[model samples]
Target: MPTVSDFIIERIREWGVTRVFGFPGDGIGAFDGALGRAERHDGGLEYIRPTHEEICALMATAHAKFTGEVGVCIATSSPGAFHLLNGLYDAQMDNQPVVAIVGQQGLASVGTFNQQESNLERVFADVAAYVQTITTPEQAEAVIDIAFRTAIARHQPTVVILPHDVQAMDAVTPGAEHWVSRSSVAAASAAITPPTEAIAHAAEIINAGEKVTFLVGAGATGATDEVLEAARLAGAGIITALRGKDVVPSDIPYHTQQLGLLGSLPSLHQIKRCDTIVLLGTNYPYGEFLPATGQARGIQVDIIPEHLGVRYPTELNLWGDVKATLTALIPLLRAKEDLGWQEKIAEEMRGWEREMLAQTEVTFETGANPRKVIHELNQRLPENAIVTADAGTTADWFGHHIRLRRGMRGDLSGRLATMLAAMPYAVAAKFAYSDRTVVCTIGDGAFQMLGMNELITVKKYLDRWENGRFIVVVMHNDDLAQVSWEMRTEDGNPLWEGSQDVQSVDYAGWAELLGFRGIRLHDDASVGAAMDEAFAHDGVTLIDAYVSKNVPPLPPHITVEYAKNTAKALLRGDPSELAVIRDSAAALVTEQVERVKGALHLGGRDDDGPR
Candidate 1:
């Protein structure tokens, strides 16, 4: 007679969960026996331990996002389950295929107010696409199957809550029959039978327009190639949301700029000039940025109907999978391979690219080009490098400029943008896949959030040094927050603002103190050499790059709302008006100098720096 834990582990294997990432707890220990048996039976299925459950979930998300498989994580009772929420939320928000197994307190304790017990299902309802608590033995297998299907089919995170009592009981035997077959997401028809006649009319308007633009969002991620093909077909320029940046590589010819609050000038300028704007799988947040004069015909393609007409007034809304819709529309549409349109948009893209490059120059002359260092490391590292970023200027810079090639796996804390996740995430990444190089990019501010505790966990893996060699790059910008400038009040009065000058600490010395190798890179030239050494060194190593704190957190885009906020701040800057003005002037001068220097192939500062 097999135990229910055996059945659960069998189901996990059948669902193709090779590695389970999580920290163990008392409630989950009952399944440990089954996990051991499953690992013995299936070579691919193993458990990977992390310092925290959030790291477990985040690591699973990265695995799922890259492999397109259902990433699995298991956590113990209430406290453990709660810890997994952040990573699960990230998975859900990013639409990554992931399934989390949460162990609840025994059913007898559900309402009795026992320790580590609550309605775990309700707690995770919003975080998971499908959430279920298993009290009956008969429902276990089906619940697991549904969880997998929900994650794999809809590309959303799913959760299965298992009470310790139910998990410990004798359940039905598990076998291959319990597994569901994997299926591809359905595609749309080649013949674009317009969802409505308005679609055709809008297409005609776009075909006739002199300047056309495409806004790509998450909806268009799957159809990136198709969308690009359509952009080429329609002779239009293209920009993407932050979510869609991964869809287009930096070298794409007609790629304009990313839009939103962080959007760039090329996208905004083109949006104003275009007579037709085709929204591909994107729901841009700012409707005001969208043309409203009725001169620009708006065509939208999205799988979700509710999103239609929400961001901007849609002249045509075609509901379907992004790739499917594009495939169908491409055949029905006339390819306007207009060289003039491409050239015009390309010119705008070039100008914005230059301006964008110029904005990063301030960090260079301030000395260490942290951005340039990261850029070089990104280029030099293996494509399969696993990079985890902590929130702050580090996360912002990487999100804006880090080029993620096909095999690279990058994970962030979604919009919550929590600090201290990088170290744990990098630890988990190393634990999850020993063959891949796992690197954590964190700011001095953020690195301290989870500081020495993470090192203890890394030390535990000393027996498996090959699998535990984690590389950490601490961007020491020497300010509490690198984006803020020192300020003074109006009439020469001082107002305390910005990160108080961060205390100087030798981060490398700290790492070395913890029995790990530490290297300090204070200049741009040494960054590459230090990282290479760190990567080659066995076990944990830290590369602390001292960067300038004066550089602004230049977003890819800025909106009218942001400008208005700036104006308000300016008007209210009675305490530090002069300093704020000086900071603005300095930023402008840096931008101008870099713009001129870049074109002439002479550089004054290495401004394209990172944290």
Candidate 2:
């Protein structure tokens, strides 16, 4: 007889779920037993086991982001189940569809303080949009159906808890009664668009201004043609939020890079100079970097109603899918004959590109500049490569140096801003598309936290992939670089060793121990060779890149007050003061030289340079 666990496996399969990320525990043994049976008898779900429950959920979220499907993860009750909170929060914050199936203590032990019997519903309430507990075999399929449907339709994480005994019960059919509802595996959604009059009004607002700019986010990922057409009609520059960095190709003349802290100087200048702002599919959350309230005419459109008009004081708000809305709004906009505004933005970007490369060229006595390390790797990224960046100074390099060409994919923890997600994200990408080369760029601090353990996961599955082009780049700086920068740049505080310093590890040595190719990135000269060797290898490779700890990730637009505060913090006996000042001086010199060369257009353009 089929068990409740078997029924669940079949139901999720019917829902088009092909992979499940999980870790085994005593409470979930029944499900494991059933998984074994399904694998032996019928072609069933692909079970991916991570080193821990947290990484399991993280892989599931990454799967959703890369594959555009509902991601599923399983965990045991109590501590194992609780560990999924952080990763679930990561999915929820990023608006990914994930369903977590966790085990609970037996129903007979309910409310009796049994081992690992704490209420999980209360814990998951905040992060999950839907949570349900299965008590009987008859109730299993219905709950699984709703869980997947809700997660996919809402683009939110959902939870399903199965009691120990319930998972082992013999499968039974629900009766034809009112409460005993049976469900199907079908999932459907419609393309949403706003009213015709509202779209016309939004176009009007966007058309009325002389200097217009489009601020796009993740929602605009597939609507590149529409975004470009709209920008062309309005003679506008396009600025992508961090989440939407890959939405449009960087080489587009008026396509300025990301906005805010990790963004480009061109993006900052464009935002400040624009008279009209078209906020589409982005809740960027940085008001200071946007046009001041009432400074620009705002037109916002988003599928989620609550997200509209929150970031800027928008004059027109339309609730619709970005592609459909833009498609409707395009015809209403009158094409502007003068392309001067866009040309100016394109020229500024041309200048910023030189400054970006020059930032990488600076020589540092302490270590290799991280920007240069990232830039070298960026240059080698294949046309179809997938890259993931962790949160830290590495993110600054990823944002500033890496430019996405057509057909390439890249992502990170954009909203939650969590650490230790990059490695798992890369792992999932490799698992989903084994034929594609996957790259993960992370810092040493995150590697020690959890990225190191995920290495074991990669080694375990080395034989499964069709191509073995997985590469992990570790920025080996012995400090929590981003937080350290925040303390000085945001609060004028010196580096606190207790909070910021992390002990150095021989990352490449560890990889060699795991029977994989590992190389130590010793100097600037070897950057290109190391990357070539890693990419050409037929096995997993690790590059332990030595990077400067004191190099600041300067924002695009630096204010005098910000400069004063940073100077004040470093001058107040900060441990890395001398190196920080040295690097800052090198950076300033690079900027000035590049600015002049860009003005003369004498450095000559490299078709290969990041746009």
Most lDDT-accurate candidate = 2
For residue 596, give model 1's deviation from the true position in Å.
8.0
> Residue 580 error for model 2, in Å?
1.2
Error of 1 at 486 (Å): 14
For candidate 1, what is the total of clashing residue pairs?
15
Residue 331's lDDT in candidate 2? 95
Q: Any runs in candidate 1 off by more than 4 Å, and if so which?
A: 173-206, 261-263, 283-295, 304-306, 356-370, 378-388, 404-411, 421-439, 451-471, 478-505, 513-517, 528-541, 555-584, 593-611
TM-score of 2: 0.96
Task: Show the lowest summed lDDT stretch of 10 residues, model 2.
Answer: 602-611
lDDT tens per residue, model 2, 1-611: 98999889888888888889999887887988898899888768889998999999999999998888889999999999999998999999888899999999999887899999988889899999999999878788799999998898777899999988999999987888777888888885736889989988887887788999999888776888899888889888999887788888878988888988889877887887789999878889888899988778998888777788898888888888889999998999999988888987898798888799888889898888888999999999887899999999878888899999877888988789899999999999999999999999999999999999998999898888998999999999899999988888888888899999989999999999999989999788888899999988977999999988877787876778778888889888788888888888888778767766775673453322322
- Scored by lDDT, model 2 comes in at 0.88
Compose the digit string of candidate 1's lDDT tens values, residues 1-611: 66677777777777767777878887887776567766677653667776678777877876775455678898998889998998888777666789898888888889888898887878988888899887777677777777887786566799988787787888764444544333322322233334646456656767787788888876565566787787887888888765566666556767864664346655666786788888876656667678866868788877655667787766777766778667666765678856676776676567555665555443445557666667656656665677877776776666555655545566666555666777766766676677777888888877765545677677776565455567888888666553342132112223334444557789988888888998988776786788778777767888888875545455444335544555455575534345445545666676556455544543232223210
TM-score of 1: 0.80
State each model's CA lDDT, in order.
Answer: 0.69, 0.88
Give TM-scores for every candidate, taking all chains together and pairing residue i with residue i: 0.80, 0.96
